[model samples]
Target: MKFTSGPITRPLKMGAYLKVSYNEKRSQVISWEKVNKNDVPTKALAKLQ
Candidate 1:
């Protein structure tokens, strides 16, 4: 994991952020706020199992 700034070709707020995660065979882009939501976690956990 790493944190980097700049090289953004657009404008956004401070809390507006994105996350990219890659496993051995898959990759995904996730929004910070959306993924951290209380409702989202419950729904996601149910689907995972």
Candidate 2:
């Protein structure tokens, strides 16, 4: 699965990262994960291993 940060604009609103897991039919999401930047402090975001 892949995850990406939400829409970001100037002034900073501290968005979030979204990821959706699909089921066998792929008609609906089976599970989801969300991580908010609100608690991570406003800073430059980067990739990690």
Candidate 3:
């Protein structure tokens, strides 16, 4: 998985995997993970993992 900070300037490709964690107190994302050209997790599959 690839991780990044700050905002993205372009659109993500199909099957891109992303995981994000937001910090409500700070009003921002505290953590992020992304895997380009990889399979994105389905709702059910995400829940299982």
Q: Highest TM-score among the candidates is held by which one? A: 3
Across 1-49, the per-residue lDDT of candidate 3 in tens digits comes to 3434546555556555567788999977787678543455577457746
lDDT of 2 at 25: 72
Poorest 10 consecutive residues by lDDT, candidate 3: 1-10
- On the 0 to 100 scale, the lDDT of residue 37 in model 1 is 33
Give candidate 3's TM-score: 0.41
Better of 1 and 2 by TM-score: 2
Better of 2 and 3 by TM-score: 3
lDDT of 1: 0.43
Of the two candidates 1 and 2, the one with more favorable lDDT, higher being better, is 2
Q: Give TM per candidate.
A: 0.21, 0.33, 0.41
lDDT of 2: 0.49
Using lDDT, give the best candidate's number. Answer: 3
lDDT of 1 by residue, 1-49 (tens): 3443435544444443343353645553332332333444566557655
lDDT of 2 by residue, 1-49 (tens): 3333345432323455544577877676667666565444344344421
Off by over 4 Å in 1: 1-40
Question: Which of candidates 1 and 3 reaches a greater lDDT?
Answer: 3
Measured on C-alpha atoms, candidate 3 has an lDDT of 0.62
> Cα RMSD to native, each candidate?
7.7, 9.1, 6.5
